[model samples]
Target: MSHEIEIHADGTAAFVSANTPGWHRLGVVAPGPMTVPEALKLGQLADWNVRMEPLVAAVAGSKCLECSKPLGDKHDDMCVTGDHEGQDDSRIVDEHDTTHAVEVPNNRAVVRTHPVTGLPEVLSVGGLDYTPISNEEMGQTLQAILDQSGAIVDTAGSLRGGLDTFITARLPKGIMVGGADPVELNLAGFNYFRPGKSSEFLITPVRVVCANTQAAALYNFRSRYTVRHSPNAPQRIIEAREALKITFDYRDAFADEAEKMIKAELTIKEFERLCREIWPAPDPEANSAVKDRDDALTGTLMQIFKGETNENIKGKKTRGTHWSGYQTVVEYLDHHAPVRGEDADSGRIRAERALVGKARDTKELAFNLFQVA
Candidate 1:
């Protein structure tokens, strides 16, 4: 029978199978708007291990343990004849040798030698045993979180590398803003494969009607939490929930800031200045090659400003505002930025990194530019 995850009314998770009499409680599901990785760890679904391979050696016959081949005369010379004085003269022994040929057990060796061949074989040595959370387990964890937090999954999928995954969940309704569209708060959870990189759960506020995703600038730090795939990962996930809950409280503040950007107008000269600052032209003293590169960037930014790029800039109010320009740069970086890598997966990773960095910079520029306005 297949094992299945079950969530009870009390928000506790369990693993159950037809053979088992009762549900095995994994853990109390944390109130989450958490990332898939964090949810898995918190629900006792995922773990980590340090893997090890064994080493071995032959007891006799100078045969190399790795290749299982004879090492010429050197090993042959080490074999000594056994001397049985009064017990048995019939015992076979090489002439002029007195030592018995017996398999000597080495305490350091983890694997035993073959009885007939007298050759030692390598074995796998288990270290830091941990059970990895399967895709199914992650799904269950996400469901439990949604049920407990009263949220619903908006989108979920595997990232560039199948090992890494992401899920975006819409928080409970009632978050609203005046003079602008009602704000929809979403919690995005990213589960990545790398060790120290961990996984992240971040809160993002989006304009409900336009569906434009907004980044929390000053509040970004408070809105995200990351947990490494280590022994204490579960505990870390639990501790972070309190902080994550606080992010939801900032929804109104973030919504107000977004509305300001939407209303803030930008003229041609101001737009050019912002564009140059966001992707500045290279210094005049620099080489012609560098200048050319900067000029290319400048031209691309101009295209985005003129709505000539692929980014769909709808709604007249959003057209000439700082929000539109900011989103244009973000769209270009996220979708059109040139990436360098040997394979598709690597290229996607590089492109993601570039997008994140560019988006951060653009947000910072907006904050600075709008502060004076």
Candidate 2:
């Protein structure tokens, strides 16, 4: 499955792409760019009225275990589920009353009512304080950005069975790096881990070329806005219009940096120095395993640099340029870096880090180093 795109219980793909089809080639596809409202409807994200509901457990009991008193409609003690090492202290059988529903404290179920059936499906669980930002609210957020920025919806979808959701918008124009490759800017909004605690917005600039360049762009996000879910989250989202201004500022700054990188040439020695700084030589006493990995890593980066320089960008060769070196590091980290496990879950973990986690920090370091070089 492409990025574990969520498949709804109704067998429809919970994704939609505008203008072009995604790699998975599933979900709804639009022939042209869409407004935020259009994208939401096509993406099956229009009616997910997500809300928090109290979690309750059924306990059968007439008398309290400790005091032998007639247990009323409520029970305050701890309860256990099923059989395990501990005894089933929660369930008590009452001849008069078979079951009494007691609310589980400190936790809630994230639920969405089915539009057609009126039934409810529990999407996930969270603490009592965890607030849900409904799909309608997220749509309004996207619409607000489009109204302010003149951007069009590019794609929208849910991942991992609607546990995580996202929407991306394409900016009006693109920056031409090195007077050749066009780097397009996109605004991505994401809510992770099943109506997570916060929603994240980021501006990403990507070269409209190869997968490597796209990955580099994904790793190159420099401006971000985050709003934690709370009673005031909706108001904060409304105020997030300021993010559009920040987006333009970040675009201008990135263009300047890209121009500098493309013009500054790197000598072979300088390239070696850059590698040494990024991946310091292991101590002599360090195990052979550590040293071997480091050596292999540096070697791989060198190989990538040579290949990148040879590939012509818009009729201009990037040979001996810091731009080539920067691409080398980004491509390696994004595609060639060693990650634990070979499953889709592991891929998601790596992708997450590449966006705003450890890999992001490393990419930024490389970019800064090249700017000085």
Candidate 3:
């Protein structure tokens, strides 16, 4: 999958990940962990100089406009473009072809100039409330907590042509579920566009048993802080550091939940029931394609839970436990689930969905379902 991780025209991607390569494996891969400054530089995420500029449009102008005043010594309309190619009618004079800039009301464009090329790229356009946050600002915001908490960045990058940027750091401590499965905690910070899509910070630390457990951490957790892009965004973001105190709370809660699931045993019938709840029976009027997909999905979930799938749940000692059932769903959604119109790039698409799309909701539902099952 392309991963849409902003591969620039010059062939460098705005991304960096620790230890292992990203899904598309295009950007910088650190041999070990990274400091915030190291990640920003290696990821090519610094010095974007992102800013907002007033949006304008060109329109036909009247000679009477500007009080018919002479522009400079030319004594011609300032808006005039000069010399018409074919003037078939006297009414169509060179001055009539004039166009002038007019401000577009309540709208602004977010742009970033390439530090080297000096070329500008428009990241997004929105109304008055849309504030542009520079990459430098984001780095500073994330750096505060990392400095205080002593966490080191593990992943840092931009997506969707740099419209969305992120930095993730692994905490010093981790939670060991039932004294076996290790779930580490990480702090993820994001700044993006859209009305409801505000900048956010979330905790993870899920030791990934599957290819996408890091993303699954984002999908599964509820503890987080968010701030909208407004005039006071930077200040609000600075204030967010206070929210970091909850890291211990989040870690404790996750550990407690995991322990509960580990202690709660589940039977084959219970597993089947949980699957049915998640992927409910299709209507009688449903098409054959829908039924086929549903059947395949249900079968896959069952296989993952029973160690019949490639995930090999038997290795984790989670078998016959509610924790096993929950992990099975997470693993399936993150790794085993099939993407429609699968291609060589499907892995990137799956990764994106697991991080920011419906798959996240599905994984959360699975976690909740197993919690009460």
The TM-scores, one per candidate, come to: 0.55, 0.81, 0.82
Over the stretch 179-287, how does candidate 3's per-residue lDDT look in tens digits?
A: 6667776688887854457888766556645435442332244645787788998888877766665455566666677778877889989898988888888998999
Clash totals for all candidate models: 1, 2, 4
What's the TM for model 2? 0.81
The model with the greater lDDT, 1 or 2, is 2
Among the numbered candidates, top TM-score falls to: 3
User: RMSD in angstroms, all models?
Assistant: 12.7, 6.5, 4.7
Model 2 stretches with alpha carbons more than 4 Å out: 60-99, 115-117, 193-197, 211-221, 308-311, 343-353
lDDT tens digits, residue span 196-224, model 1: 35566666665565444555454344555
Query: On TM-score, who's better, 2 or 3?
Result: 3
Give me candidate 1's TM-score against the actual structure: 0.55
lDDT of 3 at 81: 36
Q: State the C-alpha lDDT per candidate.
A: 0.49, 0.72, 0.72
